[model samples]
Target: MLRHVLEVLDFLDSPTADGPGTIGILERFLGDLDPSTSELRPLLETQRVVGDRGGTDFVTVTVPGRRGRMADGEAPTLGIIGRLGGIGARPEVVGFVSDGDGAAAALAAAASLLRMWRRGDRLEGDVIVSTHVCPDAPTLAHDPVPFMDSPVDVATMNWYEVRPEMDAVISIDTTKGNHLINHRGIALSPPVKQGYILPLPDDLLRIQEIVTGGPAVTFPLTTQDITPYGNGLRHINSILQPATATDAPVVGLAITSAAVVPGSASGASHEVDIALAARLAVEVAKEFGAGTAVLYDAEEFAKVNDLYGSLAHLQTLDGARDESVLDSMEVN
Candidate 1:
C-alpha cells in the first residue's frame, strides 16, 4: 500500500498531472500486474468537465467482486469517494497541495485492490472508487488557513462522483485545517444516515484499530457538516458531501494533522499518513463486500426515525432562497 501510495504521489505531484495522465498511470500499474487475462480487470473511466471557474477530470474505477451485482450476485456494493476541492492549486501553489491527499489515498487504494484481485484475492462485493484531477484549481481565503477551491461547485462534484449503486460510502478527505481534531495520522467520523448521526459502528472501530495498530480515533460531526454545501453554514470540509446525495450510510475517513494546515499549502502532504488512510479504506471495502461489516445499526436507526420522525430535511437547502444562494458561501 505504501509503495502504491508513493507511486501515485510521484505522478500527482507534478504540474502536468491531469485526468488522462493519472488514468494512464493506473492502467499501466494494473496492466503490469497481469497482462494475460482480462477476467477480473477493473473498469476504469474518465471524463473531462468544464465549469465557470475552470475544468477538471472525473475518474471512476470499479473493482468487481465475485458475488457483486455486476456478476449477478446479491452482495452489497461499497463506494470509496476521494473528496477534495482539487489536487493542485497551481500557479498559486507550485505542486500538489495538502488537499490532494484524498485523491492520492483513494487512487492508491484502487490500485492496491486491483493488484489484489489480479493476484486471486477477489473480494465478495464490488468496490467503486471515484475522484477528480485538476492541476490548476483556485484557492479561497478562510479564517485559519486558505482552502483549495474547486473548478466546479459541490453539486457538480456530487453529480459526478457519488453513484446511486453505492450501498455504503466511505468519503475520504484531508481534514487538517481545523482545531477540533488534533490527531496526526487519521480519524473516522461517526456513521451518518439520511439525516441522523448514528453511533460509530463497532465493526469499523475494530477495522481501524487493526489497520493502524492503534486505538480508533473519531471526530464529531455537527448537523451543519452533514447538510448540503450551499446552505450558508460552515462545514468542516467536503468529507460528508456525498451523504447529502445518497441515503446510504456515509462515514468520513479523515487524513488529519496535529496542527492547522492550509489546504492550499504545498509540501504538507505526508505519504505514510495518506497510505494509512488508504489501507483503512481497503480493509473496510474487503469486509463491507463480504457483508461482515455494518455501516450503521438499521434497527436502531428505524427506532429513532419512528420516534423522532424524518430528519432528511437537514440534507436539503430548505432555508436557502435559491440556486444563487450557493454563490454567497466561500465554498470549502
Candidate 2:
C-alpha cells in the first residue's frame, strides 16, 4: 500500500502538474485493468475563477460498481475527495508540491482499488474520487496558523466535487492548523450526517486501531467545521464542507503531524502516515460496502433527531450572511 502511495506522490509532486496530467499518470498505472469499469473526468473551471491568482484542475475518477457481481451497485457508494487548494503552493513553496498530501492519498487509494480489481479482488460498491490540481495557489493568514487559499471559493468547489449519488463521503485534508490531535498519522471526525454532528462510530475506531496497531485517534471538530464556509463563521478547515452539500454522512480523514505545519509548506507530507490513511479508506470501503461498518446507528440517530429538532440549519444553507456584524467584530 505504501508503494502505491509513493507511486502517486512521484506523479503529483512534479511542478508541471495538472488534472489531466494526474489522470494520465494514474491511467498509465490503472488503465490496463478493464478500462470500461472506470471513468475519469477533469475540469478547468478553477482557472476561470482564479484567473491570475492561480490555476486549478479538478479531476474525478470513479470505479463503477458491477451489478450482481462482487462489485455491484446495491451496496453504498463512497466518495473520497482529496480536498485542497492546490497540490503545489508554487514560488511560495519550493521543491516538492506542497499542500498535496490529501490529493496524493486519495489518488493512491484509487490506484490501490484498481490494482485490487485487476487481481480479481473487487469491492461490493463503487468508489468515487475527486480532487483538483493547482500549482500556484494563494496563501492566506489565520489565527494560530496560515492556510493555502483556493483560487475558487468553497461554493464553486462543492458544486463540482460533491455529488448526489454518494451515500457517504470522507473528505481527506491536511489538518495541521491547530494543536488538537497531536499525532503523526491520521484522525477521524465524528460523522456529520443530515446536518447533525453524530458521535464517532465505534466501528471506525475499531478499524483505526486494527489498522494502526494502536489506540484510535480523533480530531476535535466543532459545529462550525461542518457548516458551509463563506458564512463568515470560524471553521476548523474545509474537511467537513462536503456535509454541507449532501444529506449523506460525511467524515474527515485528516493526515496529521506532531507539529503545526502550514498547508503551503513543502516537505510537510509524511509518506508513512499517508499510506495509513489510504489503507483506512480502502478498509472502510470494504466494510461500508458490505454493510459491516456502520457510520451511525439508525435507531440512536432517529432518537437524537427526535430529542432535538432538526438542526439542519447549521449546515449554513438557511443562514443569511450578516456582514455588518462581521465588520464590527474583530475576526482573527
lDDT of 2: 0.76
For candidate 2, give the lDDT of residue 249. 88
Tens digits of lDDT, candidate 2, 1-332 = 89988888887777887776777766655545444644332211222233334446777777655531224347888888888877776677774544678888888887887777555676667777777777777788987778888776676667668878788888888888778878888999999987788888899999999999999999887787888887678888898988887788898999988888888888878899888988898898888877789777777779998999787787665574222322222211
lDDT, candidates in the order shown: 0.89, 0.76
Per-candidate TM equals 0.94, 0.88
lDDT of 2 at 213: 92
Runs in model 2 deviating more than 4 A are 33-52, 67-72, 317-332
User: Per-residue CA lDDT of candidate 1, range 83-197, in tens?
Assistant: 9998898798899999999999999999998888767889999999999989899998777888889988887788779899999999999999999999899999999988899
The TM-score that candidate 2 achieves is 0.88
After best superposition, candidate 1 residue 196: deviation in angstroms?
A: 0.9
Q: After superposition, how far is residue 159 of candidate 1 from its true place, in Å?
A: 0.6
Clashing pairs in 1: none
